[model samples]
Target: MTEKLWVFDTTLRDGEQVPGCQLDTREKIIVAQALEALGVDVLEAGFPVSSPGDFKSVQEISKAVSNPTICALSRAVEKDIEVAADSLRFAKKGRIHTGIGVSGYHIQHKLRSTPEAVLERAVKAVTFAKNLVDEVEFYAEDAGRADKDYLAKIIEAVIKAGAKVVNIPDTTGYCLPVQYGALIRFLKENVSNIDQAIIATHCHNDLGLATANTLSGVENGARQVEVTMNGIGERAGNTSLEEVVMAIKCHSEIPVHTDIVTKKIYETSRIISKLMNMPIQPNKAIVGKNAFAHSSGIHQDGVLKFRENYEIIDPKDVGVEESSIVLTARSGRAALKHHLNLLGFPVEGEKLNEIYERFLELADTKRDIGRKELLSLIGEQMDHSLLVEIQDISYQGAEGKEANAEVTLEMGDKVLTGSSKGNGPVDAVIKSIKQLIEHKVILDEFLIQAMTKGSDDVCKVHMRIMHEGKPYYGFASETDIVLASARAFVDALNKLPIKATN
Candidate 1:
């Protein structure tokens, strides 16, 4: 039988701990709403004792989100539990997440206490939290470093003490997947009342094994995973929410599934990045821009023919409209903006238009306009006087007819105009732009799709060109695919040296 895995998100609590990325109460609510829609089982809002601001944020999120269980973190202490319970006064469902370190190293060095005392404290904490809320979760911090026998002893005590979910964390990210999996197996075997509560995995990423360890734990009987968006947390960060979710998705043979709306993953990731001011590394799995981008000529040609040749998860499955193709020599503003968003340098409005022109000029100088060159271009405050701008565009197409496009462009202070007809709107747009720029280039491929479900939904277009034996890419998003295709055409033309593929 396929079992359901609970996705316990700690973005507001752990993710917010990223330095200089702290969010206030309102921003926390924004993230909470997004998480609710994403279908996380438990939303760990904040540590009530950490700050007055965090306590208030938890309170506000409880009021704002009615779906997921609003969880508040607390030490095993009375004050922490008191504040945690009070913070969730408005939550339709609430959980008091309380626990202490169970490892000998933590007991002796960190807490200056003995194993017996720590076990007693763990029991007392769970009991205390259970009294405040019907749903209580207990975390055995540093369980990775703790003695397996004693860890089982304490975990059993907490389950008997009324913990509905018991978290066993690789606090320092110190354990290998096999070792972590064995520990979870050992606890399941030793704990007498283990069936009373769910075993949860909370692994860090210090050794870059958080996701591996988390999966190992889940495979070994854990039914819950504690994670943060973009993997933002202390040091190397916590287990990535997207990575673990996608792992379960791709490896369905694991026979576990999350209620998370996989389609909301990208949108939620962006929301967290923007609100927390924490840019996700482009190489990060799942929601990263490069996750679905094809750059190399071999890769581009392969994916253009069949996406499954390279992509495992569809970009659209994660709220991204489609995969992106990076230019071999240069890319237009649309591709630039897409890559920039993935690389964490979003620009908008008038600033976007200004940067758009500058990006075209930068493309003229670089062959492959990937992240590194684009970052460098944005860094140098150079002259953007020679770049071209697109305006006065129109497209005409229907379900069973030919397409036509007309466009005007301003290049080097000169206004030029052109019009063309093609088998499709996208083709027509590219043809018109080629006529205007008087450049000999072939439209190798183009992709057009609606980003949302509405009559006026945004349309995203990506296209590739072969110019003088080199390939370039361009993209645009507009209300109309014809206009977006025209924008994409102009984008590709801007990268040309006024010639065709050699």
Candidate 2:
């Protein structure tokens, strides 16, 4: 029988510690539901004693989530435990994870106490927590650097005090995999009554060894692993849940099993990234943009012939839609032909050469060329009809405390100029353009974001306009916000006639 490993997700508790990664109560609940669906055994909701907002988020998560054991982090203090219990009132299965520093550095410098006092506090905290909830976890903070003998004593005391699980965390991400594995093995061999409680490993990735350390702990006898999604946490980060889970499944020698639904990994990562407004690195593992992208010539040919020759894991297994054969400057004839055929354009011989030349020219100018651009190029080659609706003219903003804007419109042989004053300059420019075009389209949403970082940065504006109850989206970028907004508005207006009527 395969040994089952318990997955303890600390995205809510520890992952939220990263600066600027704050999530509101609703967003926390959304992520908690996703984690529950992903089959995490324990969800560390939050540290209730941290702040009122954290307490409320923990309370809400405990109430909203039912599948996983909702856990609240607390110090060994009585008041912290009370707050944790209150936050977990509605949870079907509640856990109190309480711990203190046991290392000599923390004892002498941080805690200013001796090993005996630290062990006493650890035992008392666990005993007190056990009385309130059936599940009580005790963490040996900085256990990686702690004296092996003293660490074993503390673990033994916590077990004696009724800790159902004991966690050995490399809090500072300071331990190598070999040393971390040795620590777990030492605890197993030296700590009396160690078998009574589950040994959990929580590793940090300061040296990029968190996942390796976690697997090493499992190999040495730890049955539970603490991790976070996207490897998000303070400083370096915690062990990535996706990386560890996938590693365990792929390594036959490990033979560890988890209840996680692997297919939901990409969606969950994307949802978190969007909610946090953190852009996923294109080269990030598993769920990144380039995870399933093939770029090399020999690799692409091998992948095209036999996918397994290049890919060890199928993209679909991780919820990725499919592998993409992107055409770039480094692309070959086969890739170019494949992309063209997929775009519903078939060309051969001299025509193919002409199209490929045009594609290379466009690709050189643009960072990325999409299917629509290829189709437009093909349409131009075929002499297809192109509609021209809006024509451009110059415009300027009025100078005053409450300034308006002036606009000019040239469509076909008609020339019209108008001026309007409303809420702001951009609004006035839009109103003046609308009057010239004579189109009454309802503006649904308008957003402006900086395209680059600087004092005088370019801005990109996205606009959604509704015409006849159908929505059309368009975007524009420029150094000036007013121009970007006007161009975005005009772009949306241009799509109106092409939009199919409902």
Candidate 3:
């Protein structure tokens, strides 16, 4: 029988520590419910004593969720423990996760206390928190770099004092897999009361070795993996729950299994990203937009022939519908043909070769070839052009008393016209366009760079707009900077789900 590895998710607690990624009480409850539905064994809802808002969020999450052990974080102080305990009053299964710094650097610089004092504090905090809740987790803040003997001493003391789980974290993400695994093994071998508590691994990804270090811990006797969804946390972030769970499943030799609902991983990631307003990086593992996107010709061909040829895990197994074959300059005729067929353009032989050549030219000059671009390339009807199109645009100079622009947009067969003034020609054009459409949009970023150095040089305007906290990206190039900005803005607007007519 495979040993069960506890999936302790700290996305709400540690992951929320990302500078701007804080989730309110209602948002935290939504995420807690999603995590419970994902079948996490433990959910560290928040650091209750950190703030009243956090305390209320943890309390509400405890009330909202029941299957998973709802947990609240606390410091080594008695007040922190009390507040954390109070937050989980309604929880069916509650855990108090409290700890102190254990590394010599932290003890000397951060805490200004000696190892013995920190050790005493850790034990006391755990003993007190254990009295309030049956499940108590004690974390050694920087245990990866702490003195092995002293670390073992603290671990043994905390276990004897009543911690049911002792978390040895790579607080700074400073250890290599071998070094970190050795550290966990050292505690298992040297700590006399180790068996009294489950050993947990909470590794960070500062060095991009979080998953490796986490699996290493399991190899060396850790049965609990404390992680966050999409690895969203402070700095480089913590071990990713999806990654650790998938690792256990792929490497049957690891001898452990998690109760996580693998298929809900993608949905959970998106929910957190949307509520936190933190867009998931396109290349982030498991939940990233490009996690299953194949753009290379060789990779696309291989995947098209046999998914297993290029994919180790099926996309559906992780809630992703299917692997995306991105059409780009790097894509081959096979991928182009495949996508073209799907888009209702069935060209083969000479016609396909001609279109493929044109596609290469288009793709080389651009970043990607989506369906709209493909259709335009094949001389498809303007009826299916971009969601919005610039019919006519006129811009006054930027330094004029009042910059002015007249714009006309075509949405299907209808033409919408508007005009406005602004501080600059680009702004004037965008303001006029906004008068023509109905969408709450913020110009999050606007950038214009000259492709060439001359006065009449070609300019590329790249812009990002936010709608309901989600970003839409687009770019356009032209000799006139104002025109480029207008086109870029409209392109981005077209990508968004917006209403044009009243």
Candidate 4:
């Protein structure tokens, strides 16, 4: 039988510890509500004693979200536990997380206390917290490097002292998968009261083994996993929520499951990336830009034939609309035909062979082939009468005044003009263009890259729009950024599956 695994998210606590990624109280409340909607079992809001701002954020988040058990972080000190308990007074279900160093080095150097004294402090803290809150969790800081016998001894004491959960944190990320798994197993075997409390794993990514160690802990007996969105935290990072959730999903033998709404993972990742001002790495697993993009000739052919052949997880499962078959020099004829069919062009036999030869010649010169380049190959055989044409675009911007723009477009026999004002020239132009379209479109992403250095450098604009929950992409290159932005917007707009022209 599959067991229920609790997902404890520390994005607002440990994740916000990253430099320059701090969130205000309002932002913390927003993320807390989102985490509740994502079905997290526990949410570590913040350390209440750190600052007044953090205390307010934790208190406010407790009032905003109701599903997840709101948790507050603290040290073994009585004052810290009291403040943490106070912050969660508004929470429907609150947990006090208190801990002390367990490793030899931590007890000797960091805490400058003896092991017996540290154990006493740990039990005392948990006992005090249990009296203040219904649920109390005790963390053994640096348990990965701590002596297994001592770790088990302290954990048993905490559980006896009323801790409902015990956290085994690889604080320095110093343990390998085999070693960490053995550590959890040893505690289960040696600790007399271990069965009374849940075992939680909190692994760091210092050596890039956070996810590996976390999974190993689960394999042994951890019932809860502490994680952050995008693996973001102090130092290297923390275990990624997406990675852990997807890993258990892909492997059934693990015999555990989570309550995550997998389809909302991508959008949640985007929101965190945008709000934190941290860009998701292009190759990041699950939520990266190239996660579902295929460029190799063989890979593209395999994915086009059967998605399962090349992908274990469907893109739609993580909120992505579909996979992307990028056209590059390494692409094969199968990929070429796929794009050709998408553009409403059919070719076979001698005609296809003739076009393939020309495509190869051009592909060798260009790194990526886009729609314009493909159309150039089609030449007179393709119809351009119904294409959307940019007739005129004008915008004005100054220091303090709002930017204003006007746009005119020609589609077959129809001409439409629109005007608007915005925070910037590009925003104004996009707003004006939206007025001319009948369908509701939300600009999801916009990126600009400069190919050359200098005043006349050529810049490429890439835009993505969401219409009816599906994504449509556009691209344009020009020296004038405003003009390029308008062209790219129109390019995506033309691809919208709408029948009306006016």
Candidate 5:
């Protein structure tokens, strides 16, 4: 029988610690439901005793989710355990995860207690939690640096106190895989009551080894792995769920089974990214934009001939549609032809050379050349006009508590000028542009993000508009964020029909 590994997802409790990645109560509940649908065995909802918002989020998540076991994090204090228990009252399966620092440095400085005192408190906390919930997990904070014998003592005490699960966490992410695995093996060998509870591995990613450490622990006898989606958490991150799950699936020698629905990984990742207003890195593993993208000539040729030659995993297996063979300046004839053929244009030899030259010229002017631009360039040679004659207008807004906007519009033998006032400079500019264009469209989503790091960074605005149940997206960038947002909204409005319709 294959050993089943429980996937404990701490995206809510730990992943929310990512800078600027805070989610409101409703958003936390939404993510918790998605996690349940994605088939996570355990959802670490939040630290109930941290704040009222966290407590409310944990309570709401416990009430909303029924399939997965809802967990709340707490310190080894009775008050904290009570808070955790109260928050998880509505959960079908509730778990209280409580821990205290056990390392020498932590015991001396952080806890201001001796090793024996810390061990006594660890056992007491677990016993207290066991009285409230049958499923209780105890974590030995900074266990990676703790003395092997002392760590074993704490684990033994907690297990004797009725902790169903014992988490050996590399709190500082300072241990190598070999050393971390050795620690878990040592605990298994030395701890008297080790067999009474399951061993869990919670590794941080400070040195980018959280997944490696977690996997190493599994090989050494850990049955549970604590992780987060997209590797989001405090400082660097926690173990990534996608990376570990895919690793276990692909590695036959270390066959581990999880309850996660692999197909829903991408969807959940995207939902969390959108809700947190954080952009997933294009090169991030599994769910990233470049995870399945191939660009090099040699690689593209091999992929065209046989996909398995370059790709170990199929994109469709992970719910991604297909691999993108992008054309760049370094692209060869084969790649160029492939992209052109994808655009419904099949040409060769002199025709291919002609188009390739034009592509190079356009590539030299722009960072990236789109299919529409390439088609237009090719159409110019066939006496076919593909250019849409819509004049693009630019607008800007002033700053201050009460700011105004100036708009300039240019049409054939006509120029329209307008101004408006509103709550903010961006709103004023948007209202002014609407007055000038007289277009009616519903703004579905409007977002502004800094394109680069700095105080005076360029702002990029992405806007979506819905008209007659169809949505259109537009984007624009400017040094001034308010003006960038206005321009993006106007650009989306321009995509709509000029005449009014119900």
Candidate 6:
């Protein structure tokens, strides 16, 4: 039988602690609702006593989300616990999470207190919070580095004092996976009342072993995993919720199951990243941009033959429409054929072999191959109705007046014109083009590269446009950078599905 693994998300608490990632009350509520929809069992809204804004955010989040158990963070102090409880007044289900330092280092240096005094305070805090809320959780801060016997004693005392859950955090991310698992096992064996309360794992990622340590804890006996979306937190960040959930899902022998809606993982990650102003690294696991993308020839060939050959989780499982076969210098004949077919130009045998040679030559210059490059490589005539050609462009800029741009575009025999004002010539030109195209697109990324070290040097533009959650790549080069940018945008626009033009 698979035991229920509680997923406690501390994104709004721990994750928001990342400088400049803080959210207002309204934004907090929006995230709270999204987390609830994602099926997190516990939502750590905020440390209510930290500020008036945090308190209001927590209070509003409690009202906004009802499915998950709304949780608030606090120290073991009376005032913090009181404020935490008050902030959850509107929650259908509420938990007060309070804790203190427990390691010898924390007690001696951080807390400036003795172990005995800390133990007494831990019990008192739980007893205090239990009276205010039906669910009370106590954290033994820095438990990963605390003395095993003393840690067991405090955990038992808190559980006896009415803490329904005990959080064991790898505060400095100092413990190895084996050591962390042993720590959880030690408590399971040494603490007499351990069975009365659940043990939760809250590992950090300083050594990049947070996910490994968390899995070790779950395997050893810990039933709950506290994490943050996209692993956003202080310093190195916290355990990734998507990573842990998907790991357990992939390996069913873990004997634990979370309520996380696995398919919604990718979209939720993007929302948190955009709202928090943190960009997901291209290679981060589970929800990163390249998670479902295959570029190498061998890998692309294997994936094209059968998805499971290289991918463990189906792209659709995480809400991605499909896997990406990114064509590059390392890409194989199979990968080239895949993209060619996608662009409506299928080739085989000698024809495919001939294109493969030219592809490798072009791929060496371009990182990613797109529709324009494919058409040019195969010597196919331009599909006028589908291709967008920049006819003319002009922009005016002054010290005080906003920059304005006018652009003329020709597609097949049809000509379209647009004009707009923006902060700069490039911005105005892109805005003007947006008015000419019917596709609702966001320029996700725009990069410019100089071909040489002089003002007369030609520049290359790379643009990534996102339409309906899918990305399209484009590239162009010209002496005029603004014109190159416009051409790049048009190149990417040509790749959008024809329905976008409707």
In order, candidate lDDTs are: 0.82, 0.82, 0.87, 0.89, 0.81, 0.90
lDDT of 2 by residue, 1-502 (tens): 7889999999988998988889999999999999998889999999999999999999899889898999999998888998898888888999999999988899999999988888888888888888888899999999989999999988988999999899999999999999999999999999879989999999999999999999999999999999999888879999999889988888889967999999989778877776665656657778766777776656666777788988887887777766767656666555666666654566778877777788778877764444446666665332112222334434454432344777766655666687877565777778878787656786655667897999889999877666664445567899988878888887777554332111
Model 1 spans with C-alpha error above 4 angstroms: 329-365, 368-502
Off by over 4 Å in 6: 389-434, 440-470, 474-491, 497-502
Tens digits of lDDT, candidate 3, 1-502: 8999999999999999999898788888899999999999999998888888998998898889889999888889999999998989999999999999999899999999998889889988998998888899999999999999999999999999999999999999999999999999999999998988999999999999999999999999999999999898889999999999887878889999999999999879878886776777768878877788888999999999999998888888988777878778999888988877765677888888888899999998888455567776777743433377899999776643579889999977789899999877777899999998778788755667789988789999877676765556678999988888988998888655321221
**Model 2, runs deviating above 4 Å:** 346-362, 372-454, 459-477, 480-502
- Residue 14's lDDT within candidate 2 is 94
Over all chains combined, what TM-score does candidate 4 have?
0.88
Global lDDT of model 4: 0.89
lDDT of 1 by residue, 375-461 (tens): 555673212333457868777886236988787878766888888888777667667777766556766555676898888999987
The TM-scores, one per candidate, come to 0.71, 0.79, 0.80, 0.88, 0.82, 0.88
Q: Pick the winner on TM-score between candidates 4 and 6.
A: 6
RMSD of each: 14.7, 7.3, 7.0, 3.7, 6.0, 4.3
Candidates 2 and 3 compared by lDDT, better number = 3
lDDT of 5 by residue, 1-502 (tens): 5799999999998999888899999999889998999899999999999999999998888889889889999999999999999998988999999999999889999999999899999989999998998799999999999999988988988898899999999999999999999999998899988988999999999999999999999999999999998999889999999999888888878857888888888778877887786767768899876687776778888888899988887776666666766666766667778766755677889988888788777776664444455566677332112212234433344453566766766643566777877666877776766676544566655677888988889988877665654444567899878767766775665444232111
Q: Residue 141 deviation, candidate 4, in Å?
A: 1.4
Best by TM-score: 6
Q: What is residue 459's positional error in candidate 4, in angstroms?
A: 8.0
Residue-wise C-alpha lDDT for candidate 6, range 1-502, written one tens digit per residue: 8999999999999999999898888878888888888999999999999999999998998888889999999999999999999999999999999999999999999899999999999999999999999999999999999999999999999999999999999999999999999999999999999999999999999999999999999999999999999999989999999999999999999999998998888878877886786878878898877888889899999999999999999877777778878888999999999877866777999999999999999999976666767778888755667778899999998423689999999978889999999877888999999998777998876668899778798999877678887788788999988899999998889876442121
> Which 10 consecutive positions of candidate 6 have the poorest summed lDDT?
493-502
Q: How accurate is candidate 1 locally (lDDT)?
A: 0.82
Candidate 5's error at 317, in angstroms? 2.5
